[model samples]
Target: MKKPKILVVIEYIGENGNSTAYYWSQIIKKLNINYHVVLISPENKESLKFSKLYNVDSRLVKVGEHNKNSLISRLLGQIKQTKAFIYEIKKEVNNCQLVFTGTNPIVTMVFLSFFKKIKKFKWLVLVHDIFPNNLVPAGFIKKGSLLYKILNYFSFLLYSSPDRLISIGRDMTLLLEEKIKKGNVVFIPNWASTDKNKPENKNKNEIILNLGWEDYIVFQFFGNMGRLQGLPNLMKAIKSVNNEKARFLFIGSGSEASYIKTIIKEINIECNYEKAFFYGYLDLNKNNMGLNACDVSFVSLAEKMYGLGVPSKAYFSMAVGKPLLYIGDENSELDILLSEYDIGWKCKPGYSDKLALLIDNITDEYICSSMNKNPRKLLIDNFSEDIILGRIEDVVISTI
Candidate 1:
């Protein structure tokens, strides 16, 4: 039987600390079993390795370097990247029976709006992050401004063009359903890599022992420190609570990393093991180790960020059996997960006093010894790699 050709267009396929790349690589490998899969992504060592490993056709593009001095520069860089991606997709559009992609370079979706009509191929889009809606929460644009209205309308057009829309979170699915008012949204939750992440002994783990955090209950933040994370609010809470019994660890770098460091210095947290430690960024192995060492993992979202995006790192933390201390809307996906499973605590973003109170009240005995093992068990049952990949394959099959 001749298999239908499907083109996978994703911006990042590198496996170095990129969860999207790793998962999509798994998706490509799975889809290759049933479909003639072709991939278009920026050229990288991991992407090349994946293409050879899976024996799938690949069209690799050279991504340009971007200036990071200011937001405007970054926006310009993103625009350039989107144009390149669109050009590559245009080259391969007519050759494939279906096009599968995620909203990485979001502007590419606008071009897909045109391509789908021109080529008349079934387009399946996974919404990793909503664009103009998320931008408002990131403080990049106003909610009701003229520019926002224009972008939102274009976003609606882009979304309406897709044959099926895949949402990673329940909140996101609801938002999309309301926006396009269509029955095409599919809820496919993200999964964690069980092969790479497993629960380790907090007491004997090298990351914990070497950092001298054995005496304190560690609350760790192990992902991007960006605007949407509400990191400043968490920092404020940490500053207000100044408890010697709890240790704070930040394990990734982003735009707010410098600002977090400045706040840490202002709080005069000792460099020793008493207060807080900031490690800029670590590789996958080290990050997994850090996840294993923490008692509670922090997953936060800014105000009005309920359906914008869900942090994928939270799944890795859960895979290692760490409870979440989520700071965001009570209606967020994390909040619903925590509330349903009794796996963690929640707080609103911007409520520094309440967050500080909650931090002070969480005892070492409760968090360390009494917390349940549902985190890892939940993944084994629901969010495992095989399970998510199966769901994704089903969506692709239905689309085709």
Candidate 2:
């Protein structure tokens, strides 16, 4: 049987890139078994490694060096990067039978949607983050404004262009239903980065031992401390917590890092709970230690954050058999998971009182004895890389 060629256009895919790069690498690895896969991206060592390991044909795009000091300079640089990628994709897209991509550099994808109308190749889009609409929650743009309507019309076009639209969150699939036909969307949740089927022993973690947090019930929030995470609400919840033995640990750094630290300082003084600490970004491989060190993993989304995106860290937290303490929209994906599996607790983003009450009641003894025996089973059964990629492969092959 002749294998159909698939050209994957993405912005990043290497050690330099974030977790999404590793995710696509896994997806490509699975696709390589039955398809002729070609990749187009700016050069990275991991991409080169994939070229050798999976027999994927690599096409490199030039990424412009951008000045980060000003918003205008950064926007210009992104335009240059997008132009370079479009040129590279155009050069190779004709040779491939299918084009596979996610919504990074979404502007390029929007432009590519127009090209899809003229070309015969099948297009598949894996929706990670919904745009313009997502921006509305962050106060980036007004929902019904001229700019929002214009970008949303193009987003509709982009959604309609794909032969198959892969949605990571069920809420996202529902949201896309408004833009395109329901038959075109497929729901597949993102998987854990770790392959482990069981929890790592906290006693074995050097970081936990050195920090003297062995006696406390640790709640860890590790990832981008970004605007959309509802971090201010988390600070409010932390301030309301009265449990002296309930420690909070932050493992990643971003825009709200300093703000979170300032709030932690206030909490330490006002509440006299000196257990909270902000440990700046650690290397990728070291994330396992941080995950293992915590009794519960904290994941939060800002108000009006439904269907915009699903955080990948929640799955990583599940992989380590840790219960999740989620704060986000009601009936969001995390809420659904919590309801189905008894995996953890959920509070609405703005309700710091509810989150605080939930936090104060969770004890080490209760977590160890009363909680689900194996939270990692969720990943093992449903969200593992192999399971997710299998679903994706079926979609691709069945469509072909």
Candidate 3:
């Protein structure tokens, strides 16, 4: 029997590396199904490599050039991209059995939700981030602004129309339940590929030896350095610690990279110990080596960001068997995992003093060693690639 084909639309696959690409690759490889990817133009080499590796067909839509400096240019680019995406999807979707997507390219979700052609197929929306709601708290727009009101209404309409909505956390599902039918949503947390293990001997790792991190308890914050990460508060917490034993590392870049750099510079001027380091971004292959170099992982979210999106890096930290030190909403999904699994610690957002205290408390060698074992076990039990994707397969089979 022939396998069913599903059309998956995401904004961009691979200039650098993305969790979305990693995610779909696993599903395509393991599931007995075919996938067609619709992406925006200026496709990168990494995306091509990913397509070849996964045996999935990719179709690119030419949305004009993106100009980051100009708001008008950005709006025009999205307009073109949305139109192209809608046209291409309309042409190809009729042959597919289901349509699967997320809310990344907000324009695509806005147009695709209402497109008549899509209503014929089973539609599944993976809610990675809740918009307008997130934007308002982030200060991107006023809560009562016309743009906010318009997008909020569209979000309600779009979310309500989907046959199945897959949310990344329990809080997100609860938030959606207010706007969407309870039965239409399913909670499937984001997962990481568990192909790598924690290094047996950190002393033998070349990267750690080169960085001279072997002597310190490395606390790494990897992935995007965006505003929602609450990184400024983390830097403040690190400065207040006055500890020689802990070294904080920031990886990756985004809107807040420059601000993080500025804070680091300010802290260095006033302090004798080089308490923090910024290494920018690493390639996909080096991710394991980087994670292994650290003793513990740091994850943060602004208090307002709760229920808007889950910081996916926490899953990667667990996959690599490193305990996480999370700074965000207490009793959140991450907080619950840390508490129940005995794997890590959590503090309220912006509480650098409390964060420092937590770090100090975990410095005992026995405590660290004991905590390390639980992360990978947690991954195997709940967040492993096989387990999560298997759930996705069940959903697909049932939907079809």
Candidate 4:
């Protein structure tokens, strides 16, 4: 018998070497069901390569450039692309057995709200980032404003229409339960690519040598350097640290990249020691090597961002057997996991003094080495691809 088809819709499919695309590609390849992928992205070499490697029927709806600096441009681009996407997928929508998508592109949510009402396919909504709720904390929108009320209602309608709402963290699941039906919400934490991200020696890694970090205890933050990461606090913490044996690396690009550079320049004038280096975005293929070069990984979130979104980079740090230095909410899902597993350290946002102290304390050779061992074991036991995907398979089968 032929396998049932699943339609997976996403904003960008491995475009410009996106890591989420790489991670999802692994999951899509392993899925037993036949699947078709629809990407709302500019037609590019990376997208074509992604489709070929995944060996799936893929279609791309051309969209304008994604400009992070211009909110109006971003929205207009999505609106234009979404219309094309809806038209392209109209014929395939009714033929598929299920539709899987995440809360991205804004357009995807808009599409789901309409598609769920007409199609008989089981709608699986992956809540990667909560909408208007997350925006209120980030100061993008006022809570009681007319725009907020409108967006909130739309978000509620979108989320409630799904057959199953898959959340990335326990805190997210609870929040979803408040908006969505309790029975529809499910918690499935993101997984790491353990097989792809093995531990590597810092001395032998080319990326480390290139950055002149061969002798230092590196604290690296690799991924989107956006407002929600609380990067200003991290930069301040690194500047305050007097330890010559330690170095900080910021890799990746976003709206905050220019701000990070400005901060680094100010630190350079006052601090004699070359403490921090900012390396803008690296491709997905080189991300593993970049991650392996670090002695410890840093993951941060703004205080107000707690429970709204979880940093997926935490899993990559663990997969590579590197301990984390997290600066975010003390009660967040990542904070609890780090404390429970004894794999990393956590400090509250904007507490640069406390973060500096934590960095200074972990300089001991024995302490750092011991903490590194726990992450790999933790990855295998809880966050491995096979383990998480097995649960996902169960969810998919149950939906059918």
Candidate 5:
């Protein structure tokens, strides 16, 4: 059977796009057995890199450059830039039978792409990470006025009207229930690629001997250190963690980087970290080298985002089988997963002592058990992409 042509709609990608976009691109490839995928995103020059990195057939949509420096310019640029994207998608989707929108406000962009609903086209929306508050960021940008309420209501209306709504994590599905809790919301764990960059077991003696033997326990946090990552709590716990043998590692760049460093300086906590260091984000395939070098993996998110978006890092981190330390709400997806698997530690968002205690508790045996997480095993047993994608394919093919 000839594969159906699938059009994937996402925002910026390739040049350091958000992690969610990377996953969607992977999904496109995972489904290649069933679909011929065409990826569309805002990135132009980066789209080439994005294509190579994710190994997807990517086309740079003709959108205006996004201006991040000025507040007003940012909003205005997004609207105008994304509108141009709509023009391209509309023109392209004539032969495309199925359309998939990834976890982004870009669903709204897809909606705006249409003057009104086109007659027989199928639209499948995967809601990755959305918050009720963000349904209308225009509200905060504007004061407590009628405009805020109007935009919020409109945004909700747009979201609630989707044909099919899929949630990546269970908590996200529950949140969707609060609003439109009817026949639409579906739950699936985020899919991981078993084929690409499969992890290799490193012999500790060879690796350690090669590196000249580090005696400290390494606590590593990968991914962006954005505001919601509860980095402040991580840093504070690093401060309070009295063990000289415990090293706290912060990887990736984010808004909180400066503040975190400032606090580390204000309160001399270098002792808290046996060998404190900042290793900026790098390609994941290359960074797997660093993973073999680490003793533990840490994850955190802002308290406000607890139930909203399930952090993808938690699943992969656990797959790495290093003890996972995630800071978030008790009910958040990562917290629940970390606890259920007995894979690592969980602390409430913004609690430093919990993190400190977690750091002090890691033993060499614990590290060995954690690394046994066997990501491939977990995927085969729990979230196999073949099964998950088959389920989604049934939805798309049936819709068409």
Candidate 6:
């Protein structure tokens, strides 16, 4: 008997600093019980997800690397990529009944979506972030502009390409249901197994002891510090704390790092400001060491991101069972979660005093107790890798 075959399609084959690629890779590996994997991408770029299955592939195809300039240039690349993708995966396309595309980059998903239609294969689209919707008008897409109209219209239609949409959060699912086939939508939360993190009730490791015993608190910020994430206020709030001992640690970067640097300079404070420190962007996947270093994990979304995009970090933090100091605008998902769950506290976005006070108040015991609650039980029940991967398998098996 032949093993089931599945094609995992992503926008590219690159190892982005982002965690989605890693998650994509892991899901496919876990699905091996039902499918023999065939990985496809537009770029020859590195993806740890693709790397592991390279030898196991029924087929591994790189349709194109993409040229990032000019519409015509990019579209031309897409067309060429589409053609090569079809040409190279001709066998796997037929052998596999299901195709799944994207944790991000709708363009890549679009190509795979189009391919499934031609091959008459069933495909599912992973809704990672609600694009164009998440794009702020002033910074990303200006208001009353043709590009704005195009983005809004395009993103709406893009939601339709998937025969089914697999979503990572409620906010994203709600967005898809409004625009696409509601029957095709499913709430699939991003999840990490509990085995990945060691619970730290009274973590008195040598490392913790060597690094600790400080008068001030450490406000930790990890992941991409971008405009969409609203990190300026994070740093600003830290500055406002006005405590010689309280410090801020920012890890990771994006297009907005320069602006944050400017804020730090304008404030004329030295790096690490007494207790302020940055372990810098940890190659998080390299080892689990870095993520284990903290008592509390920070959750943030740009002031405007509320209701539009669910922070991916939310589920991950819960998985680790960390006390979250979720900072965002009023009525936001994080705000509601922290409030109702009692797993953590909330800080009003852009309000330094409130954030400062919250950090000052957190106790090690509080963080430990919250982690013990398994607040993500609802999230895990639906979105664990097992459930989501199984759903993808079913989509493929049904098409076949």
C-alpha lDDT of all candidate models, in order: 0.82, 0.81, 0.74, 0.77, 0.63, 0.60
RMSD to true structure for each model, in Å: 2.1, 2.2, 2.8, 2.3, 4.2, 4.4
- Give stretches of model 2 more than 4 Å off: 52-55, 65-74, 193-198, 364-370
Q: Between prediction 4 and prediction 5, which has the larger lDDT?
A: 4
Cα lDDT tens digits, model 2, 153-265, are: 97777778888889999888899998775588899998874553246887667767877888788888988888889999998998888778898888898878899888888
Candidate 1 error regions (>4 Å): 68-71, 269-273, 364-369
How far residue 39's Cα lies from its native spot in candidate 1, in Å, is 0.5
Candidate 6 structure quality by residue, lDDT tens digits, 153-242: 776667776677777656556667776645677765566555554445324533335556233344556676666676766776766665
Question: Candidate 4 on 1-400: residue-level lDDT in tens?
Answer: 6677777777656623565665566656666344444433445677778777656677766666767557678788888877777876686787778777777777757876887777756888778778878887667889899999898888888788888988888778877887765578878888887878888887788878887878778888899988888988888887888777887888888989999989888787788656788888787777778788788899889877767888878898888888888888766788778768888888999799989988988766633564435798899899999898888877877776
Worst 10 residues of 4 by lDDT: 32-41
Query: What's the CA error at residue 357 for candidate 4, in Å?
Result: 1.4
Per-residue C-alpha lDDT of model 1 across residues 149-216, encoded as one tens digit per residue: 99888778778899999999899999898778889999998888778888888989887888888867
C-alpha lDDT (0 to 100) for residue 200 of candidate 5 = 47
Q: Weakest 10 consecutive residues, lDDT, candidate 6?
A: 199-208
lDDT of 1: 0.82
Question: In candidate 3, which residue pairs get closer than 3 Å at backbone N, Cα or C atoms, i.e. clash?
Answer: none
Q: In model 5, how many backbone clashes occur?
A: 3
Cα TM-score per model:
0.94, 0.93, 0.90, 0.92, 0.82, 0.78
Worst 10 residues of 5 by lDDT: 134-143
Model 6 Cα RMSD, Å? 4.4
Candidate 4: misplaced stretches above 4 Å? 32-42, 364-373
Q: List the residue pairs that clash in candidate 2.
A: none
Instruction: Report the number of the highest-lDDT candidate.
Output: 1
- Whose TM-score is higher: candidate 2's or candidate 4's? 2
Please provide, for model 5 over 329-355, each residue's C-alpha lDDT reduced to its tens digit, 9 standing for 90 to 100: 787777677667756667787678877
